[model samples]
Target: MLKMMTFFQGLPGQQSLLGTLDPGLSEAESEASMSEASSEDLIPPLEAGVTPDGEQEGTSKKKKSKGLANMLSVFIKGKKKKDQPRSSETEVKSKARPELEGPPPTVEELKAALERGRLEAARPVLALERELEAAAAAGGTSDEELVRLQSKVEALYVLLRDQVLGVLRRPLDAAPERLRQALAVVAEQELEDRRAAAGTRAAALVDTLWRGGVEEVAAERLGARPAGVPAGLSEAESRFLHMGRTMKADLEAVVERLKPLFPAEFNVVHTYAQSYHQLFAAHLDTLAQFELCERDTYLLLLWVQNLYPNDILNSPKLAQELQGIRLGSLLPPKQIKLLEATFLSNEVANVKLLMNRALELESQRWAQDVAPQRLNGYCHCELAIDIIQIISQGQTKAENITSDMGMQIKQLLLVELASMLRSYQHIFDEFLEKSKLLKNYRANIIANINNCLSFRTSMEQQWQIPQDSPSHLMDPLKELKAHGFDTLLQSLFLDLKLLFKKFTQTRWAAPVETLEEIIATVGSRLPEFSELQNCFREELMEAVHLHLVKEYIIRLCKRRLVLKTAEQQQQLAKHIEANAEAIQSFCTQNGSTATWLHPALPTLAEIIRLQDPSAIKIEVATYATWYPDFSKGHVNAILAIKGNLSNSDVKSIRNILDINTGVQEASRSLFSLIKVV
Candidate 1:
């Protein structure tokens, strides 16, 4: 059969189908060839017909060709029968032998094949790689072939790197399918590397392809200066602001678009998040090397320490996606501390400058004899408003940097606030003394009093400064408050002085007229009191009410109204009770929350009205209960006014009062204000 097949290959118009086919193919290649062979390979080439195009010259030639084909068929069939057992044995031996699969792709072929293309287009090259690797493993491929195969794979990955990174450089949402394809490539490469125990090669691809792509995107986005940069912002300030805006936008795109397309093992969200964070930190470190201004320093600190970590990284939508990511600070801790220190120093100086500027402006107004502005029918000044706003805003911004920074800021504000208060106090005193515009002066005094009240309340409530604890803050406030109140109410006090004098001169005879006149005088001032702020109005009213009660009792304590008769003492007690009720009604009606002072005058009247010694003793004990500051001297003074009690009776009453002493004192005391002579 072999001799006949070889002899046929040399004949004119005749060729053998098995002429060049190799029977000694390695087992693997033989199986591959067997599976891959087509029907054309099993059949002879078209008979050397009239022409290679399969055209016949004539019918005569076609008939002759038919006779020839019949003879060739008979011969081929006989040969196949004779070689059948030998062919079976050859196929069996080929299966049993281990053989090299094939030669790997040539360098030129791989280079041309691995040219940059879409990630999906690289599948053919990867298939070729698997075949070459199998050939090498079967122990039939030479070292040269193995090295060539290794080079092809390395070049293929290089192409993959370029294509994958190119996909990542575009916006995540621009071609989500393309991003998905690129990630799929990375996933396969990672799996291949893992099975081969090729450490970190897959990781390097992710770092160079995904992370490097992020750095490129971030740089491009951050370089875009936003429209209408505010006029006064430094270059650093504008850049920092733009960085925050762009970082958030890019990270959000990855989370919203790419996360769903990739699987969890890909760590798509964390990869994007960490890349953005590391790049951001590096950029901030560059910025921190310079001497930033106050605004820029604060903005830098805000982004690194607060805004990035809390508002951006932990935002509701992005937080869950980035939960697995451990992106660190936008700047190193030491750098952040330096920025904080610079910001706090600048803020401290800035606060002082603002407060001083506000004070200077107020001083100008005072020097120009400007009338204090009226707001909602009340005297108003911007001194407190401006200074408080300065400190409050400073403290708020400082806190945005850190809590410890905020406390330091508060301490700085306290010092500046104390100085401002002291300076304002002196300027106000000079203005009140020298300014000739009487109505404007009075309005300014009242406004300044309101200012002090407002300032103190803000320190205590908003700043949480303990009252009566920080003498520097509270003591200056106290002095300014007292002076302003005394100056504003000087006339009111003089009027009360005359009213009380008239009562003592009348010897308790015209109690109704004298006390009613006093009540009328205090009521007339309520409209002016109403002009003060609510906080100030209440405080002023309480002070006046306590002073009135103290003055009334002091007049009686003068011992001029000695009621020798029981009837006289009862009448006087009725007058005192009526006065106490009228005073309380007026004070309460005019917005006094000093409910503690309500019983001070009434209890004193009850002690005078009681006829029996034991009754009087019980009333004195009640007085002591209400006004724990009610002293032995107070009881003696009241008894002397009664004049019905002998020395022995007074001593017994005093003893009863002593027994009830040491009770809890009221928060605001009227008896403590009175000095019984």
Candidate 2:
């Protein structure tokens, strides 16, 4: 107790008060009583003897006396009663309340609070940066201090850039709040950047953030130089293919994921599109410098001109999303033209080489006495099929570039194909004429005829060759068709010539043995007609039919023995009718759909068997209507067979049969293939 009295004696004015209050108690006990009293209850002294209003009311001695009088009064009163016990709750409040009501904070403390807000992401980091910039500009900040602040600001911006890019590069994982904060910072920096300069790119946040994001995505997806590419692909080919596929996928991600996160003013889709387009163009520009292989060249052209535009930029999802955005071409027109020119040059050279190679291989087979392979009884050769496919593929690839380019490629290939086919025909002609084993190669020649027909069809249908087009790609193919048929049928034609020679007066009076011989000869070979492709089989049968009709007509037109009597005319007409029946039956059975040619011989027999000159004239008129293509020369030839007709009668009959008038322009001419003396 006395020791506590000694502690109280140290307080101002407390020594005299404590001595007076307890003379019997020791001074130490009195001091201990005062010491136990709460120090927080004491009034705070004025700083440096200044009053609350900041006036120097008195000297330090006067302020200390005033504080001691207040402390002595409080201590005398407190010593009058024992100290009261405090509750735990009241003790905690007493300890905590003073700090809560403490004096105003310092400037450094305010700064520390702002920094904490920024670091903790509670405040916009860019706002703190802008405040720093404003402070530095306000003056009195030392260069060292400014540099330190600038470094800190730079670190914050860098972190901001990373966050923005992270949002772009991994949008699905980024938080919406973090993304909004990043965009707000970018927008704020953008406004500041625009206000500062007209055309400065240095330290531009928008470019830095957007371009960094796009480049990171491109590099990651496009991948480093492809090491082990797929089979048959060169390094460049593999790189371009990978680049195209990945760029498309990443841009789609940007459009679908990142674009909606940013505001419309940011133009996220267009911005990413342009960045990818420019980057891909740059890559292609580098590649175009080198001499790429054919595969790589085609692949590059495909990406630039076809896949990039059609499959990537204009893909259904991207196109719909980027309705107002105009991301333009992957490469500029001038560069694309250069690529096209290169591709065309390569294709032209390749087509010519392939055509020559096909011709050479075929010629080798001929030289080696290798019989052409037979497929299902039809002769087959790979030359025409191989050559056509090569040209077709080239044209198809060119078409993939563009429709106009496709036409250009087709024209080039058509010329090449025409030239090659001409050479092929020459080779075919040379082989057919010189080859000793002609019978063994007969089926092969027929197959080649079918090949020429296929070539013509492809040129017309696939390449869109017009009937009257100046290219005349059809001319050589037609010649090839004619040449093949002419060579194959030369022997059959010779047989027909000899049999028709038997149509003299004696054979007509007999059982028409010559007609039966002709029928047997053609019927034996009719099974071979099935070997030709269906479309051409009818054509071959028609050719045989026309040949037989023309030969028989030529024989009768010779007027070797005229039927002077009506009975003789009747007998001769019966023989002609029977002959017509046999020929028409053979042609129709052998797949000749030209039933139009079936009535020619029967109609001619009707004109011959008639006795009255007027009746004959009507019959000739009907015959001419059926065979509009029949000429006056043919009518005169038929009149020669009817020996009883006078010159006047023949003239009237000939007048009824006009060759030119009323003939449909599209009519097929059978007599045109025949000649009479």
TM-scores of all candidate predictions against the true structure:
0.66, 0.69
Best TM-score goes to which candidate?
2
RMSD to true structure for each model, in Å: 14.5, 17.3
- Of candidate 2, the 10-residue stretch with the lowest lDDT total is 1-10
Decoy 1 TM-score against native = 0.66
Candidate 2, residue 189: lDDT: 48
Tens-digit lDDT string for candidate 1 (1-677): 11112211222243323222223333233323333432222222333333543345677665544443332222222233321322222222232222224644343444444463556644544554444433332223333333333333434444555566567666474577777787776666565445433325445545554555666676677667777577887777777677777778778887888778767655767776776677678778887788776777888888888888888888888888777678877777888777777887888889999999998899788777688899888888888889989999999998987788889889888888888788877777777678745557777777888787678779879988778666777777677777777777778999889889988787777888888898898888877766788877887887787787888888877877788888887788888888888888888877777888778777777777777999988887877777777788888888888776789998998898556356886666667877888
Give the CA lDDT, 0 to 100, for residue 562 in model 1.
81
lDDT winner: 1
